[model samples]
Target: MNDKKEIRNILLLVFVIIIVGALIIAKFYGNNQKERYNISVIAGEAHAERWVVLQQGLEKAGNDYNAQINFYTVVNGKDAREQKDLINRELEKKVDAIIVCAVDSQEIQEVLQKSERRTPVILIETDLKPGHLYSQVSPDNYEMGYHLGEEFVRQQEGKETTAGILIDNDKIAAQQERLKGFEEALASAKNITIKWRASDYQSNERVDNIIGMDCVGTQNATEISKVNNEKISIYGFGNAEANIYYMDKGIIKALVVPNDFNMGYLSVQNAVQAVEKDMVYKNTIVEYIVVTGDTLHNEENQRIIFPLVQ
Candidate 1:
């Protein structure tokens, strides 16, 4: 009778151990099947060449981070308003986080705030004016602008004494910063003087505005050069088209190139990182590349780029 009782107790202990072990295995399996997080990236427009490189980088990041990332693109040449509306729709989808390449920084900020009212937002490529919200994921365009200023001074070291600024429109932040930075650098150079103009008009009008003056509008550099045959140096975003125009016409002496390819790549990389677990991102700034004589000589070397047509 004693032996039988002991055997029964051993059997009960084994049964209890098996039950607990099975429960632990089941819990581990359940947790492994759960999703981590979903990330969304909004490109202001679909047509720009730079966004193409950015999108690839974004996808790669998603794959590496083990997160679900959807890139939403709108029609090219659409208004910033449309991009904002589309962003709102994505926000409603309840993504874990968002990354935006704003069409118009100021206009886009208004939309970002609404989305952030629900989740964290990271602004990439472009940034809102001070005080709007979120971390900036781009370079110091203003500083790039100042660098433009200093670059002009260095370029004109022993040459002409008169120069000017061509801004794209009063609207773009990068153009404005380039203009400002260029002027500040020229300020200390006694040999050169700068003028400011808008690129809204044609070559004839541009020449009329700055024929005797140095021109600096971040817009239509290629066209602006055709108008201003005077010995003028341009300080604005570099475009391959514009470079060819200037090279053929002998108009632009130097230009500030925005590495759009890299910007696109970095912006998307940031979006991917922000959405991933145990990942982090530091905002990037617009870096400067100077394109001059030999470098801008050939189409192959020029960097005003768009994605390949599929």
Candidate 2:
């Protein structure tokens, strides 16, 4: 009887040990499966509000897909060389995929050509020339600009109109496309004249009748209006806090806002697909909406404008 009891105790101990070992193995395998992807996202400007939302979207998608994401930001104002170095570093690290918001599409062409064949390359908010990239995710800049132009014409209401356009930079593809569309939209309007168009945002410059082409331009127009105690009819791109503040005060007339959260989310989703499934990604264009002071508070508009919180 004593021998039999001792043997039973030994058997119980063996059973416990086996169960624990099996649990450990399962946990290890689950963790390994969870970390199957390593996606790298590189942005042109780190401090920008739009980029912040983009990063939020990326994090959300990463969590949903059980993938790891490493994000890099370009400081010191959109330096192409800095972006190129970051891309090369990620390439050397052998990251599963790379997402880039190129500062100068032309300048980064060589590095992309070298690294794209090895790893999937995704472009966000910008595009390179010759157009044969792995993928591109951005808003329809031309359509946004054309919509703003249409609003400007509506504001004029058949009256002779004179306006100045404050462009962000003509060299940027997004900005160039926007400007082209705006011009094309206004081509038939003989009564409206563009008095001055420039990239610089001068606080001392006239803002009485101005069409700001971007966030910086809109801010400059607002500051000029504040200094001069004048109400300027400003229309531009972006949904920054300051832009909304000016809109509330009735200083800014209209805005063309991009769905940046979707841009970021889709970029990463496509990147993961490219790496894991060998998927081919085409141009993924994010949608935009026009907002004015009267329509800013609408529920649908608020959702797009404040995507991170939602």
Candidate 3:
């Protein structure tokens, strides 16, 4: 009887020791693994060209930092109501953070402000009217416009030139800023006559130069110039593959390409920092490049022009 009791006690002690050892190993691994975060991105439009590059950046950063990105967009770029609804839905779903491209700066300001109370909010491209956004990632629209204007000035070489400017009619702040900066650059140039027109307008006015203020505008101007067979010099902003193709074919004379991939990657990176380290809000103005036919294939620009995800 004594021998049987001793044997049972020994077996029970061994089982407890094995169970405790298993739990200690499990705890060590659990502590070593970093917690993955859920991040949501709300874009102005679905399948927009700019967003394509930006999405690549976002995905790359998400992979590097162990984040799950939930990307959402409205069918219409200017649909503020839909954007508001989407923001509400994401908030209810309890996403860790939100990165938004405001369709109407004013219309969505209140919603964004409210959402910020619950989670960290970062703006991409367009910012709010009151400028209350704690953080934003975008290119300097004014600088880009000014740079394109400078390129035009260089090409014209102070010769008298007739030019038409094409810009989006959405009246977003970014577009407006681009227009303002371009106009300011041209303000001191006495040899150019400016004809301002909305992107939707189709006019037969033959001009020596055509300028577009954004990706869609650039593509539209390029198409119009091609279809009309107008002997015109084209300059605009964007890094769409189509724009690059046009540049290669000499259809686009000058292109202002914003680093949208950086925009995407940095915005998410900032959001993650805000969540984990309680980082303060900051505005990160991404870089841009002015590429001409002659300089398009340079090694520095090629990386941005043809981004490869590793």
| TM-score for each candidate, following the candidate numbering | 0.63, 0.85, 0.91
Global CA lDDT computed for model 1: 0.55
- The number of clashing residue pairs in each candidate reads 22, 0, 0
- Give RMSD to native, each candidate: 7.1, 3.3, 2.3
Better of 1 and 3 by TM-score: 3
lDDT of 3 by residue, 1-310 (tens): 9999999999999999999999999999999887898999998867777778889999999999899999999998778899999988988888888888887877667776665455777888774543433488888888988888888888888899988888764557788888888888888899999865666546547788788888878888888878888777788988888888888988789998888888999989988987886656778889989999999999888878667732
Ranking by TM-score: 3, 2, 1
Off by over 4 Å in 1: 1-39, 44-46, 66-78, 129-133, 161-164, 190-195, 203-219, 224-235, 238-255, 258-262, 276-288, 294-310
| Residue pairs clashing, model 3 | none
lDDT of each: 0.55, 0.78, 0.83
For model 3 the local lDDT of residue 306 reads: 65
Q: State the weakest 10-residue window (summed lDDT) of model 2.
A: 199-208
lDDT tens digits, residue span 1-310, model 2: 9999999999999999999999999999887875568889987666665566677789988888767889888884458888888999998998888888777767777778766456888887665553444678888788888998888788778888677888754545777778888888899988788878886545435535677776656776777678777666778888878888989988888898888778888988888877776656677889889998889999889888898665
Runs of candidate 3 with Cα error greater than 4 angstroms are: 1-10, 114-116, 128-133
lDDT: which candidate is best?
3
